[model samples]
Target: MSAPGEKAASELPQRLWLNGRVLEGRKDFERALENASEQERPVLEFGLRWCSDEPEMVLHTSGSTGRPKEIRAKKICMAASARMTVRRLGLRAGDTALLCLPMDYIAGQMVVVRSMLAGLRLVARRPSRRPFEDLARAPDFAALVPLQVLSTLEHEAERSLLAATREVLIGGAAVDRALAARLASFPNRLWSSYGMTETLSHIALRPLSGPRAGVWYEPLEGVRVSSSPRGTLAVSAPAVGVSLIETNDLVVFEPGSDRFRVLGRTDNVIDSGGIKVPAEALEELIGTVLESPFAIAPLPDPELGNSVAIVVEGTPDLPLPDFRALLRGAGLSPYWKPRSAVFVERLPRTRTGKLDRTALREAARSAPGRFRRAL
Candidate 1:
């Protein structure tokens, strides 16, 4: 609809996969960059790369584990991944989608790519801890980090607006039990996605609410999951060009089942004498009783090779003995209970929201006495 003397709206450029800007040439893309906001520039740059004649573009891995690296990603493979999501989610033309994650990452780039391919109307917003404080409309779809969801749930109007979202995807980090408990009966279809940078986006999704909630992540269409000799996850999905990529995550796979549960990262396993203790498992146990931001990490021991220690962001409500008693009450194996506790101002996190274990371990090792004490 147009007012008198107003020109009709032009169709979005299919080649550049854009709706707002006219990108008829490289010059137009460059011009958009000059006028774009800091938050908007990342995706606009990505859009320019897509518009270029080159078949491949560089994408940086989310350095949650280690250093970030740039890898050449194919547009064809990216489109295939987008199409797979379209089919899996049953998205249709003109559906409204909220794009909030940083466009520099695959998750954010895929939002734009998917919306372009599926003809979904995109509403782009800057990434924030509170995702929808400003947006007025209830989008049909949205992808958000757990922190954003948690913040949104704290507000009545925000929660209601979020509840109206038809398809909600949570990722960028593991959704903890506490967060999952809050979303157990969300009005819409909520899923916790699992994937990495190399996979383009999620290859599996865990149901977070409804009757199907609380299960292992089921593989997406065209995805095959297996295990390596060391119990690490192996994925094969040619549609996204991933072939038998052995992940560092250790898992338990059923003999003939497609669903698998991730236990922990092999690198995080701590060996004390002959006993192997998984830090992730210990962290889960501690999470059961401790509400504050905390982690289970291995602290070097002169007697044993390493000992399990609790690293918390701040002081807990109860004293050390009470906390230890709480751990004992949780039925945490006597041998597995953290022998000590370390307090820090805050836990370090990677750009993509994963815990910065290397940084935390370094800090703990450097100043064990400054913040750590026997529990």
Candidate 2:
């Protein structure tokens, strides 16, 4: 495989399908490439001759917690990933696929790569709030982010398009349980992809229905998975990536089974009074008892060293004691309950719509006179 930026002049130019029309052919595509290259100050060479055997594509992290940077992955690995997906889903040549995600992300790139590798026709559509509404036509398969899936569930036209699709893969963020339940009512095969920019998309796919809606992973062939002593998930796939990727996610292993359920991120764990508490697990527990969305983070506590605090999305109508009692009933140890419950209109989010933890911590520290230890 040629490295990124080294393309042979003899190689055929790639096509672009957009909004129900094949707007540009090879020559047109070349012109557009030159245009973008000039605008972006082309650091890499141009075209087949200039392109490498294994072309590199840079994926930018969403930067939910900090600034985003580009991570490079080989084009050959992407093709391998596409081939694995085709075999996993039983996709055949000539199948039709809809591309609805922003082409800038890994999820969107996988759609195009899969279509190319499978000899399937591609239909590219503009990003919209109603993603499936303006589809050129119903397709055999498609990939969506979680938010897009939720939007489809709420709209009749989008839902119809979704039902017509043969296979659908959803990722980019956690697939909320409520949204997954809504998708279960449909006839299409729904899958939740588990991966990241570093892994070149997903190394594992968990089906969304039929006895294993949210269970273990049926890993791609050649992908090796193992858990660390700390319960973090790790992967080594020759065709998928160059090296073993260690994720910050925590998982629960099922005895006598090959599957595992992702619990939360390891970075979110808080150590208080010699006990390790997963802030995400507590957030979900508190989310059930509270009326609105909230985040749990470790705040400085002179006594316990670091104590947990709750930050709500909006003002709560319930009393402080009521909230505390709910947690008590839920079996959160006295020390695990919020040291203080702070009300903020909305939690800060990153460009990719994930919680901004760094900013949230700062906000927690600046809140006036709200520090009261629960224990």
Number of the top candidate by lDDT?
1
- TM-score of every prediction relative to native: 0.89, 0.79
- Model 2 score (lDDT): 0.68
Per-residue lDDT of model 2, residues 1-375, tens digit only? 554654332242344343233323345445545544231112112222123343566677766556778998766677778888998898887788877676656777777767655766776666554678866457888888766776687778778888888999887766655566667666778898888777888888888865667656667777877798778998888775547877888987778655767888988888888878888777766655454556787788898888788877665443444545766887776666676776677777654345778888877777665432343
Q: Which regions of candidate 2 are displaced past 4 Å?
A: 1-17, 21-28, 31-54, 134-137, 287-291, 316-334, 363-375
Clashing pairs in 1: none
lDDT of each: 0.78, 0.68
Model 1: lDDT equals: 0.78
Q: After superposition, how far is residue 123 of candidate 1 from its true place, in Å?
A: 1.7
